[model samples]
Target chain A: MSLAPSERPGTHPDDSNLSATYALVLVVEVIVILGLYWIGRQFG
Target chain B: MQWIDWAIVAVYLFWIVWTGLRMGRKTEELESYFLANRSLPWWAVGLSVMATQLSAITLVGTTGQGYNAGLSFIQFYFGLPLAMIILSLTVVPLFRRANIYTAYEYLERRFDSKTRLFTSLLFLLSRAMATGVVIAAPSVILSVIFGWNLTLTILAFGIPTIFYTMKGGVQAVTWADVKQMVVIVGGLSAAAVALIMGLPDDVTVGAALRTAGAVGKMQALDFTFDTSTTYTFWSGLIGGLFLSMSYFGCDQSQVQRYLTAKSVDEARGSLLMSAFWKIPLQVLVLMVGVLMFVFFLFNQGPILFKNTYLPAVQSSTRAAEYAGLDREYAQAFENRKLAARAMAAAQADGAPAGAASFARSEFVRNDTAVREVRAKATALVKDVTGDPDYNDTNYVFPTFVTEHLPVGLVGLIIAAIFAAAMSTIAAELSSLATSSVIDIYRRHLKPEADDAHYVTVSKWATLFWGLFACFVATFAAEMGSLIEAVNVLGSYFYGSILGVFILALGVKRANGDGAFVGLIAGMSAVWWVDQHTATVYLWLNVVGAVVVTVVGTIVSLLTGGATAGPDAGKSAATRAA
Candidate 1:
């Protein structure tokens, strides 16, 4: 029997939102780096 | 420092210690002392996470990096947000669910006791030494600004921290960290505002940044794939990722922060908070450095940012030569100032990027001349002082704060520096004590000790590490740039430790034997790579982690891997491994 993701955390078998959150973080990082690159190109 | 400034600093110091002592009253038991009985709020834990990682070096050393090298250093943390996200998914939940005091405890349960002892011992060594560098960063730099003796300053920073952390425990340290984190952000915000305000009347913020861009201070990203380059998009994204994983996932100092949260989700929540804010916060920090560069472009910045060496140079035989360089520096400063103003004017007049190219090149050229003059003066100081390794990078921000900011603000920024140093020292001290008592003292020295006895041992452990860190600080002050000094020290050990955790969690056929041998191999490989190649320090983390996983796996397969016990290889994510 697997422990419920809410009460007991384990392998990310139940929560797809957690993956979304991780993906969101990566997306945000990409955007931030792109923004920084733009700043360099604009002025640097 | 003005009387009001001193008053503000004095009040801040006294208030923090008093608050820490009061909150630490409930830490009578081992769990409560070390983990606050796992009852802390996510926001508070989140703030504590930031407080521990963002040290005095962030203020004193990173700002100098911004001023000296520009935004290139920002790439070093490019992997941080992702690392936090990955950790929230893995260790934040794993360590919390496992109900472990130290991350190493899980290693023993998953692998063997030897792996647990060895990993924890490595943490104790790495963190204790890194803590000393953290303590050294602010005290040595601030001593010059405050004109206080280095030893006294080290004490002033270390003792209050040691006293409260010893008595109040992690609970006290965490609560104090929340308040200190606020002061740090507030001070940085204030410094940012004052820096913009200090720009010359003719130079707008946009104009100033454009001028900064001309000299490459505004460039925040480099696409270079060179392994020799320290901070690049690739190095930061890949190399920094491994380093961050090792630090937050495997290192006890960070694991302990999230473990204080009420549940697994809350622990992940705390790390997510860092994920969202860490990069933007770093941007603000580097911008402050860049703005200081712009601020100095028009204003008359000293030839030497450090005032401490002035006396020695004045008394030496090269004093006359130093005076001549000083005169040349003034002219170079004027040339650079005029070029900066012209660049700003061109931007204000709506010149296109292509049209303003000449002005930018002129500014860059003049800036180089200014650097040459300053370098000559610095050599004179080094020659006369007989301190061949003298560096003024850490002094740049502190000296600027004292020399430039309004009176009360100076005190606030200094207090922020104090906050940065004390918060880190408190966390490390508290974590050091936890690892010592939980892993070594109780586990080995006296396996049957009660809570009260262990708590007493923990306090003495905190005291011992505190004084040891203070002693290390005196010598660590001159190793190099305080920021890089701490990170380089960590990079040497962080990757290998992370590799061990990977073996236990991800590699199913890996046993304690594999983990142990893999750890030694990883560390030795990191050392070998560092000695043999110019592959930059960030990439060393990658080398260490990869080498360990590969070596551990081969050994584990050869030894027929441990597949017997119910708890064997039972990691949080792969519980049946």
Candidate 2:
């Protein structure tokens, strides 16, 4: 089977796309933590 | 408690059974029975994964946790999204590409049949016992709350699950899960709405949340670096990550869910769905509990939520002491109600920061006073009943449901709890059937059999396991400490299993001898660390995984490391044989 450029091992989008997905998930997590922090400070 | 409520629950059971039976027609072959012919859509498979992981205990217990601990428990899931992402990249593709029936089936190819046999045995033993506890928990809680017989309650939870899973196979389990997910989520949403409506009209939603925040219920993030604490941000993120990895990647119950997906990308999508939604879903569960806490602030609630021994406590010699403590709890609860009102009002009125903070501190003190009285009452109950390790957290949500929810809705939520139990039970029963037949029965007793013959035997295997799990549930409930024993056994095995998988996929040099020995070393280390140190269950997964990898690497190198990949897997297995 012929492989797509991005689908090949050690290639761009697979690596880069996975990295982006990781960044996005982690970033959202940090935002959630910060949101909780703000609620505690504002309301607690 | 009403006739209408009973009808609603009966209808739910009948509906689920009907749906499951309808799906059973597709399971004519072994592949279809276990893996749904590998044609399932990602979304349905994703819901099945979520529903199967959630159990009746978590449904009831988490709300209780929210009522008691607030949002700090959410940190326990901090590593989940990352775990899902990692598994998508690694195991989702690996397991799918290997095209195996059981996760341990790969172990045989990667190492040796003995390794596959050993790992599969570990999965079977731990999972079988754990499934029993899963059935017992809700039944015990329901029996206590509603005056139902425990034996019948166990059957009520178990039999229908067996019927559908035995007849319908994995297709039935997955489709039923899709519907159960709807019921489960709907019930939680209904409870949240009712709790909000239950709050005194004088208290706004904002005020209620702020008051709960004052007592630390709204503090979802605990960024403490303390390794000693259970639900801190670090523990949840790091320890939770390892646990999630092990659970989703290594356990067949979960692996079977994704393995049915139509493509590798579909498999990855299913896991990523969990990655994106698990914490938020947990937040919804925890928020219901927090809302319950808020609802109780203005309302009177039981001092001790679980009242199984309420009669005994009343009739025993300690009755006077229990009554006295009850009175103390009432007074403290009353004071806290007033204090919570003031705190909520102050925040709503935009009181000066100093004044608001003062009101909050008073509220906290009053809450502490109520909890102290509860501890005394709980102690008195333990003395009277001769059952130790008793706590009331599991009872809180069920109690709230029966007392506060409208009659029809109470039945719906009860059915929802049943849905949760059935979803988990169904998945595990099918998985146990799959592993027992494919890994042990077929692989050993009869390596060659028609699909029809195997499917017939697989059905019998499913029935046998269902009955066996029900027996275990009944036995565990009678032997109260056995529940904890099963839990500890699972905690010991989960990480070690994951460690073997990591050694297979990530370490090319690791062979059968190394993987097998590494698994033993990993479990032994976890046991030793658990006994010798104060390391919590979460960190133990990390320890097990790390020790197995390091030990396996050394053992493999000493044994002359791998010749290469899957071929190495086969060669290593042959050499080990």
Which candidate achieves the best lDDT against the true structure?
2
- Error in Å for residue B307 of model 1: 3.2
In angstroms, give how far residue B96 of model 1 lies from its true place: 0.9
* Model 1 Cα lDDT, one tens digit per residue, B127-157: 8888888888787777777778998898999
Give the per-residue lDDT digits (tens) of candidate 2, residues B202-292: 8899889988887778887777777667788889999899999999999999999999999877887788778877888888999999999
- Looking at model 1, the pairs that clash are none
The candidate 2 chain B region of ten consecutive residues with least summed lDDT is: B568-577
Clashing pairs in 2: none
| Docking category of candidate 1 | acceptable
Reference-based lDDT, residue B111, model 1: 75
How many clashing residue pairs appear in each of the predictions shown? 0, 0
> Candidate 1 local accuracy as lDDT?
0.85
